[model samples]
Target: MLTDSHTHLYLKNFENDIDIVIQEAKKEGINRFILPNIDETTINKLIDLHKRYKNITYPLIGLHPCSVNKNYPKQIEKLFQKVKNTQFIGIGEIGIDLHWDKTLIEEQKSAFRTQIQWAKKLEIPIVIHCRKAFNEIYTILKEENVKDVGGIFHCFSGTIKEAEKIIDLGFLLGIGGVITFKNSNLSNIIKDIPIEKIVLETDAPYLAPHPMRGHRNEPKYLSIIAKQIASIKSIDIHKIAEITSKNIDNLFFKKNQNII
Candidate 1:
């Protein structure tokens, strides 16, 4: 089976026919969908989806870096309450993003650090969302000495050197639709990196792959991503699926596959 390691099935884009979307994905062998939480607002929706599809969907919780603001302390408190109250696969969609605005850079760092601490305390992996702030993120991660709890760098778009650094720091490169872009350098990086250090994701409702590019993305498109990787690495599609799925299982579902 294929796994879309990072997606937001709780988003409104799937509101109209989420069951159909999920069913279609299952039909295509994209059975496991890892749902990453954005903020407090989507917590219930994420949990509800997990409850409804207990065996197929895994839920991750965190305050997305983009949502980090002056009131982040309060937000973090609320998030902690939820983290303590539920069973989550990981802590995620958290990190630094300077593309949209840099005014909240400090706040984002604070939030990221707090969540990293939480992940370490909880003994769970993290799902990172990094964009235009790799250097800053790497600095904090290094300073915090957060090596025990690893995670995926969701929607990775970095140089091979950066990718290597992240792997050394105990994180996997999350490959998604961007790798299939005509001018993308991801294919080259994929060729260089070991498949074991990689993970598949859709970041669905965004970053749709080619042919499906410029359109909405979903878990079903993950097969296309697996195919792309197979071609890039010159490995069989089943091998890609098996190894990547095993990687996800190791990181997120090792102790309790039933929950995912």
Candidate 2:
């Protein structure tokens, strides 16, 4: 069994045939999927998907960094109103994305800090999305004095130094299709980081691995990622599966069980 630590099945990319996509993933041994919310607009879709696939899907609620804008406070209020009564696996896909628009940088930071407080209050983990703003994100995390509830750094493509910093902050590095890219420096960093600090993800409908590069990603493609990690680490695929599976089990599932 493989766990996709992060994915957005609520997106329009899977609108037409989500059932079939999920069935195919199960058939491929990609059983568990952790879905992260993008914004208030996607919450209903996220809840719908979780309700439909309760056995295989886990829902995480949060306002994504890129979605942070001038009306972000209003968006966050909507999110909190929706989530206040429920228990979610995490608060996530939240961080700064300077790669797209820098105008909302401070707004994104404010949103991130607020969400971190929510996560701490709820005693849940967080899934962060950082793009070209690692330094700022790290600074906010530090200022918040974040500890205890570590989270996943989704689609991690940072340098070894950055990886170390995140790990030191009690976060796990999420590895996906990028690690399978021949030119991706992620492969080199993965070689040095402990497998215990890694979690597998597809970031589905995006970041498809080599061989399937350019094709729309799906959770079923996770095996290819596991195989690639095994090759890079010079370990057997089963061992890769075992280690990553255990890491995810601890991070998301928490309860002890034989996932295989």
Candidate 3:
């Protein structure tokens, strides 16, 4: 009953054998996959996978920060239109990323604020993607005051202070394969964070855990990440699975248990 709360199974990286990838993931106890949208171009592929996988896959709609540009306003408008017309589980894979390029920083912030407002109005959670701009992202979230429909900070790799700030904002930390990297201190950071305030993700086709580093990641390898966490926390892997799955249920399904 493990859940990969954030993944991009729709990307071309998995296009060749996505069905096999999904099958193998299920066999490894990773039963649910939550696909986050990148931008307008990824909407159809995200929806197609959700339609084909139905109960096992969930979809979110939003523009990634890396996708923001001068035309972000128009892009956000069109993407919001799609969200209104469709039944997405959330709004995200959105936020600010200053890692690669900061040329469109203003545009990225504006787009992030716009999407957060829309999600707040719709009462849907958001999945955030942050890079070298944690302070920038946190400032905007605070300005938006997004505590009501708090979502996840996808691929969180920040300090304990930063983690506390996110939790204070009522958002859950999205822990992923980063926890397994020997060079990453995420395992140490997360050991002090409660399991209830965390969710697992692969951010697949990227950030594959140790032993599989530099390789194309698949959702099937989530068990390896989970096992790593278990070892670090000195808890059974089954408890990690149970608690994290329940955490996902609380956020997405409202603890319904019947929805996904």
What Cα-based lDDT does every candidate model obtain? 0.91, 0.88, 0.90
Global CA lDDT computed for model 1: 0.91
Runs with alpha carbons beyond 4 Å of true place in candidate 3: 255-258
Higher-ranked by lDDT: 1 or 3: 1
Per candidate, the number of residue pairs that clash is 0, 0, 0
Order the numbered candidates by TM-score, best leading. Answer: 1, 3, 2
Q: Candidate 1 lDDT, tens digit per residue, 1-260?
A: 89989989999999999999999999999988899999888989999999899888888989999888899999988877876667898998899999999999999999999999998888889999999999999999999787888899999999999999999998888999998999898898889999999999999999999989999999999999999999999999999999998899888777675665
Cα lDDT, model 2, residue 9:
92
- Write model 2 residue lDDT over 130-152, tens digit each, in one string: 99999999999999877777899
Identify the runs in model 1 with alpha carbons over 4 angstroms from their true place.
256-260
Worst 10 residues of 2 by lDDT: 251-260
Better of 1 and 2 by TM-score: 1
lDDT of 3 by residue, 40-148 (tens): 8999988888989998998999999999989998998888887655678889889999999999999999999999998888888999999999999999999999998
Give Cα distance to truth, residue 214, candidate 1, Å. 1.3
* RMSD to truth, every model: 1.1, 2.1, 1.2
Candidate 2 at 221: error in angstroms? 0.6
